[model samples]
Target: MNPTHHRRRQLRSVGTITAGAALAAVLAACGSTAGATAQNAGAGTSSGSSAAAGQPVSGGTLTLALDGDPTCIDPAQTSLTNTLSLGAQFTDTLVDQDFETGEIVPALAEKWEISDDATEFTFHLRDGVTFSDGTPLDAAAVKANFDGIIDLGAASFLGSSYLADYVGTDVVDDSTAKVTFKTPNVPFLQAAATATLGILSPATNKLTADERCQGELVGSGPFVLSKYDLTSQVVLTRRAGYAWPSAAAEHQGEAYVETVVLPIVKETGVRAGGLQSAEFDGIFQPAVQDQDALEQAGFTLTSRANPGNVQSLFANTFRPLVAEEAVRQAFQKAIDRDEFNATLFNARYAVPSSVLSPTTPGYTDLSADLVYDPEGAKALLDGAGWTVGADGIREKDGTKLVLKLLSSEATKSAAELTQNQLKEVGIGVEIEIPESSQSFKVRSAGDWDYTFSGLTRADPDTLRRDFWSGGQPNSAAHLTESPLDDKILAQKAEVDTEKRWAIVAEIQKEIITQGYDIPYGSQLQIYATRDGVQGLRLDASSRLRLYDTWVQASS
Candidate 1:
């Protein structure tokens, strides 16, 4: 059951690039907030062969349409996928994950080792690397970056969650640093491969967290944040002497594109139209309904399954109507996940059978309890002393079964569909589509009865981050002092992968049985590009890797 034990069998040979040779040359390069959110679906390869295919052509600007403006460009501060996508363009992590095999590979740190107890992580930094501001990226810089995240406290929601159980970091030398944890942190190694834990320049780290969010942060990546217009766009220019690229990067030199312009296109229709008309070279979160038209127009659609938590309608148990276990269970049973996926995602996305997506390591099938049973839901509501009123909404003790549902604009359609589905079972839901950052604020404040969201991480430990009472963004059903918390903590500290998997399975069962979360399906991280664009890749975590992407001239 130890997922890593089966990693050898799961190791897939991808493209013509061997990881060992890539790392030896890396002597090398470097390296979401969506609950494993929606991405376009296609085979995991670059799109179209043209004059610019096969080799990277080092010029031309790549304009991408983003579904929303980034909440913040600071990697240590925001967890939203839009912001994470922007972060990837200008920040570098200590490690990287192979897009195909999900293997951990070298990036900023040439190599790393973990202690037997799993409490100590020692990283050997690559020499001669420097941040955009001409600052050396040494071990102290890495420590400063982590220390900055620790200093942000609750402000660094996603970043702080990744560094849980931290004792402190020790800079052994210019090229060496040792990170110590009070408890075994089996997820830290993979967390280091994420953008949230990416290293920043010490000069930028010296700024207050608020200052960094205002665009003061710097990194040793392939691009520099040349312009940031909060309401309009973000502009990045390729770094001149950038050489260190992640082992998973398509090339080991400067980025092929001279610049990347990420324009905020909040509406899916606008994004799809822009890509089809060539007003934008690429777009994120294209509408599923637009896939066929885009293909007919000679555009290529691509997506990869996000490898983490499944998309679910999270009920806020702290709310009065949802406070009853029976009510929550009724809500779970009322959801028709099959119909939801079919209508919103077509067949490209997988309907989740458990809280975790199939792509996640140690995932287990837990679909029996997830079947759609409208009658069973009604019975549960009736048993809880709820009766349907003449108006169709259920009533219990003078309280109507009406709840406010919050979601981002990206998920509004699905939220509306859910509203209709829940109505069929005598529950009334009012949907609210807020801006992405505002939506997170409302969910974190526990101000809404339910919210639709998901987080994407290759590690199963994401469960701890999402469900632990002490977790960052701690938005899990307000269940404190439950045995579930104990199991979650145990899994986090369990170094043996197999035992950890068992503990996670138990935790998933507990959540499902207790009706803590109502999972619907996994999200396919999709993107659309004009034909002849090459080297676009979605990493294992579903964020874009565009460092080596190139635009071929139209024939």
Candidate 2:
């Protein structure tokens, strides 16, 4: 199945906001990246509230802290959702995006076009441009970077899945190139704008994959890689002669600031404490506690409903209890989403109903109105032949209602919340299972009942990979793949825009109607910044772009 076949497998897209809206506005602030914004769970953030949040200021440094040290800084090799996104803040894509509208405008490749059937795309590479290393960014350079990524195969899911086919790119001229897919691949441009496809210089490709472990990290963006030590941190400096930037960017030459530092901090308390103590200038992250504090601290809270992040409870269909359609429905019914939204997350999150959020391109409110109906849940379980046992748990065919609720160190707290709530429905939930990597193996191996997991991407096609039949665990992975899901995905890819929504709506209905996994909500996005940071914007893709920032009293 192609990546676009069942687009909603990834994060859902929410509604759109016009330009000049809070998030789309790139205003200057006193502190620049030094300012801090509050965070809340499931509730993502983009600073708003303060009118000056839209003001502009330049000249200073921005200190950032990431969740962890990256597995690899070679954007093509790794796929830590946030790692590549952070790279976007420092690297340039073939095209740029408007966050408020998600429109693909232009970036490195000045302009592009598509064939009549929409199967081919030709990009006119910009001239007078080169990587930080001074190597020209010609059409040949673009082909080498992408072709090399595709060669990595499974190592680059972003390239493989996002690019659709292993098709080659043709260099029409020094400043122009055309790419041909096996079939209609309109979203290629959108994917091209992703960091995974950031055009690297010839020097980048020359370095051994391991040697290039964040090596030199030169790009045509406003920031140049100064230092990248996996165990330490990734440091960057402003490009001295930089000029090209997003049209919305202000003071567009070399950035006003001199440096950008991204440290590694994983603990929630540490992240929050570090932000509050002024130990860091800015962060691209979300947390339940920080957002609550920000609200009370009078910090700006700018958020728009988008299917940005995902927190999923994967129901192991191979397990008898979990395989029962009614039992899966029971889990959803027992979940107090509002309580989770208001209490567990400090009212910073929203419970998402559809597999693909309403914000997704083909989104619909098909299941948005679904309610927590315990009575209905119980009725379905009764019909499934599950009866209450002596220990207050249900049993059928000598199997108890017990199911392993797998979680990692990161999600332990969320698991505890799940355990507390699920007991009310007479379901036995247990934690202390394997970690994420292991859980992926176990679930794909069909060794467990369910695994708590999630995925986030900028496009609707992400849904197809996660839920569609072909996206099932690989054969060697020994996981679930459904023919029904496969059929649904096929229908979506060929359906026209107007009619595609109808198909997507049905798919959402089916996902909810079957209740394979209980989607808590698309987790919120948040960041903390000093009051002085400016020229910060987050597009629908959740990319971090700060090339236009300036500090008030920058050194």
Which candidate number maximizes lDDT? Answer: 1
Local distance difference test, candidate 2: 0.62
Question: What's the lDDT for all of these models?
Answer: 0.77, 0.62
Q: Assess every candidate by TM-score.
A: 0.85, 0.83
> Which 10 residues in a row give candidate 1 its minimum summed lDDT?
27-36
lDDT for model 1, on a 0 to 1 scale?
0.77
Q: What lDDT tens digits, residue by residue, belong to model 1 across residues 499-537?
A: 988998898887776677788767777777876677777
Shift of residue 126 alpha carbon in model 1, Å: 1.4
**Clash totals for all models, in order?**
12, 46
- RMSD per candidate (Å) reads 11.8, 9.8
The list of candidate 2 runs beyond 4 A from truth reads 1-57, 116-118, 247-251, 298-309, 366-369, 435-440, 474-488, 491-496
